[model samples]
Target: MNTDPKVLIVTSAFGDGHMKVAEAIENSFRRRGISRITTLDLFAVVHPALNELSRRFYLNNTGYTQEFYGLLYTMTSKMRPEQFMGRLIHSMGKRKVQRIINEIQPDIIIHTFPYLAAAELASTTGSRMPLFTVMTDYVVHGRWLHPQTTKYFIASEDMKTTLMSAGVAEEKLVVSGIPIREAFEQTQDREALLRKHGLSGDRQYLLLAAGAYGVLSDISSLIKRVLLQSSFDVIVLCGNNHKLRAATGELFQENPRVHILGYTEEMQELMCIASCLLTKAGGITLTEAMAQALPVIVYRPLPGQEAGNAEWLSGQHLIEIARNEEQLVEQLQRLEHTAYRDEREQHMKVFSRKSASDAIVTEALEAIKLRQPSVPAAKSMLVEGQAKTIHGYY
Candidate 1:
């Protein structure tokens, strides 16, 4: 364990998806023999009150408050680069984060959540350490493209072009796919994975992932609607919402084909047994599903980042958006056809099945090495010595 190369990962629990990606990257680093890793939930430590507010807003009153978040995103989208709320949050969070950074004194700081990208930029100002951001969403957000970022890790080619258009030097971006849990990359036979979980490939599996905060979002209604029209087994994973899970579990108890679980680490296994997913277009879940070649039906994606992810998925043909129960049912019926299944598999082929976590850790190490004075100039070459490796076309 070379304690000299300590890396600090800054994240938040605004959503479980972001933290999951950070955890994946951290695990990847450890797997590659880079053991000096520190992961922090910035909001948890820096401002517990604000974190609680976010939790209540998203988890407790999601239906009523979702529009407010949408309005905020719309406002931020139209506002000038210098006047964004993201900038304000950074200004407010900078001092506390900077103090933490000074104490940790890490060689590199990687951020998976853009909630504090601006704050992180401010924290590392004038410091010798390098700060990089791995964009958690498939779509690009101005908040994630920090002007001072040492490097930008992205999920897709389109994001790179958006960043370049925003004046980010093309050379500094790395396409590392959305960082997913290493479990998604574990080798296992499809039959074995299904049998281990008492699932049958003979019946199509529909996996529903309620968001981390546990806002039901009418997803259970959508699932029930779909179940009424089909014989496929429905497996719903309501992450962290025991009440919602119990309520839904009872609702489906008489129906032998429906299963409900409250927060389990068996998501990858479930994905292997499932053919279709119904969930929010969270970056982490979306990427994991793609890694497993599971086509998805997205429901009520959050306004900014998640909406972007849904749009990307739609463009990729990896998913279809269904904001209402009717639409969700309609899409599921349409996707049940063998033709749609073939198309979905073709779309899944576009995604990289290999572990992005490993790729991210490799790039992180290279980024650190590039920052070292001892590394030769030739070793500093970026992406095969091209001034910019553009893949948005790919």
Candidate 2:
């Protein structure tokens, strides 16, 4: 491995989960003494206006008409880069990627989000670099698949199997788990974290993870329902959504059991103290919660990739999925049983043992050591005095 490595982590703002995964991978690379890391939002860089419009459309479509989003997901599940929509999307950022490759000359390019267009720089244009794609969700959406991808860092064996079934070479896939923040790697003290958060062990905590957008629907009603079910306290994480936080705070301020908070960096601490989690099925949060052995309950997951993530994990008994308040509460009630909680915890711990970020870094670097001018990106960027390639994706 080079003493000083340049890494470009291409991510999107489609959801904060993808960006969070990129951050985690960046942190991991930094730990390896590799600096010169740049995290990019490729679409916004290529065409800011269109990116914003599409972003708004995504938010509106997913937040309101989720059934349509699911239908789209199903329709595009088998799309190839040569197909109409896929070709259009995959063609967006080639020039920007080539310019970026010439400018930064990164050693390796990792995609925490799925943007297949990056591969066109090398795959179609005869450039070369190591382009690794990391799937942040449980679903293997066709958007992420491409023949040019050097490696596929997937979430589970299930995804590897799916990709294999799709004719992807088995050797090209790595079940290294999803990359999480460096914070999850440290030893978190339960008692100390409890004191720091003004929480207690006496009361079981129900964590409502609204993620970065505060996307939890009818969250107040859900909180009220959970309160009615038990004496357990509630902690709401309204990420970046100040209005939702303020409204939730105003509504629940008088209730001693309910604590509504905006974005706080003490997420690991909160998850440490939490007895159960009620949230959407975004892969990054689910991976973080599972890594802490926290029982995850997906409540009315938005109908596309979220539904896919919830279904697969739930089927394996690793997590519970609820379509309504009643089922969500029922899942929480079941967690109250010591035996049931322990069983779920056991399933979660099995997954927690895999050090995803570290494994990814080690394997990527080892590949570099083994094959000097690895992949397309390395072809332009330098490796041992030769020009290197750029793993160009955003």
Candidate 3:
């Protein structure tokens, strides 16, 4: 009698943030004793070739054709609810997604990606299973809203207002602060982490993470400039970009202050040991850096979501933006001041909420209980009201 609530976490691989959020939620479920869990990438399952091609195209475009990509993002962001793209995506993915739902019969389906699959799942008849969406970005886009989303776990109360203004009911939105892996929330002894990684703990560390795809621009130039300063050591995470690793290794081989690492599972440990993080403004990385309470220096954020994230974080004073090599050097130098570092750290403490995963898991469990047939009719009525209210928006 395996009676633990079944959960299906539907995510997409278009970006690493969605997958990371999925992993975080999955980890939270396991911690809460939910054994029956399934994680799936809708595109990978429904349209494998398109998934691969689109993912490749996205990576390449974000790395190179950023202007065109931003244009596309802006156009799509303004799409109306009746737009054809949503319907087209729903049609393409619905059958496969519905089949998965039929097989698993999960108590709930959690979506960490954009809401196309959720729109498909919602369109299915007799689809009583609750669907919850976790918005990885600080800003909300039109694509993230759907009538079928029973709840939205967004990054902040301001986002909740954004959704509500767009017609989402107050009860259906939770300000969860972007769920991140539990490992990030754990305290790491800075000295132990540095010793284990064979780095000097006495010196301040500037952690340069270019994301898992090595999407940042002019990383070598940034590294070269940072190395000229004797106040801090530079640690660069090149992720899975072999070309980048090779190029950087050759460039910095003689420099003892520089360390280049490939894709690593030790991000939490690394973030913990670093005095500050210098990276592009991917939502998950921003949240992760904030979780570690490490001051951030954002450099060359990509055109769309990354730019939005940078704007929000910088506005909050949780991060400093460096638009060029000169600005990057200046921001790095600014980190050396005790007042500046402490001020940013305090901002991080106020802005970052590490309990998002746990909070989401708890709310989901409650939603499941309310949806149970044994629950009171009044609770069911409330859910129905929410669904109807959301439908009115569409």
Worst 10 residues of 2 by lDDT: 385-394
lDDT assessment of candidate 2: 0.77
Q: Which pairs, if any, clash in model 3?
A: none
Task: State candidate 2's TM-score.
Answer: 0.89
**TM-score quality measure for candidate 3:** 0.89
Give the per-residue lDDT of model 2 (tens digit) for 1-394. Answer: 5777777888887763787777777777888888788787766676679988867766763455677777888999998876788778788867766766667667778887677667866777654567889898888999998888889998888888899999899999998888887676566889988888888778899988754323445778888899998666899888677778888888889998998887677788888899998877888888888988899998877777988999999988899988888897888888888899999999988866356878888777765553334334423322231122122111
Model 2 alpha-carbon drift over 4 Å, by segment: 61-64, 210-217, 369-394
* lDDT (Cα atoms) of all candidates against the true structure: 0.70, 0.77, 0.77
Error of 2 at 237 (Å): 1.8
Regions of candidate 1 where Cα sits further than 4 Å from its true position: 1-4, 60-62, 78-87, 115-125, 210-220, 370-394
Task: State how far residue 346 of model 2 sits from its true place (Å).
Answer: 0.4
Residues 243-293, candidate 3: write the lDDT tens digits. 788888898899989998888888889889898888777788889889889
| Separate clash counts for every candidate | 0, 17, 0
Please list all clashing residue pairs in model 1, or write none if there are none. none
For each candidate in turn, the TM-score is 0.85, 0.89, 0.89
Off by over 4 Å in 3: 1-3, 61-64, 211-217, 372-394
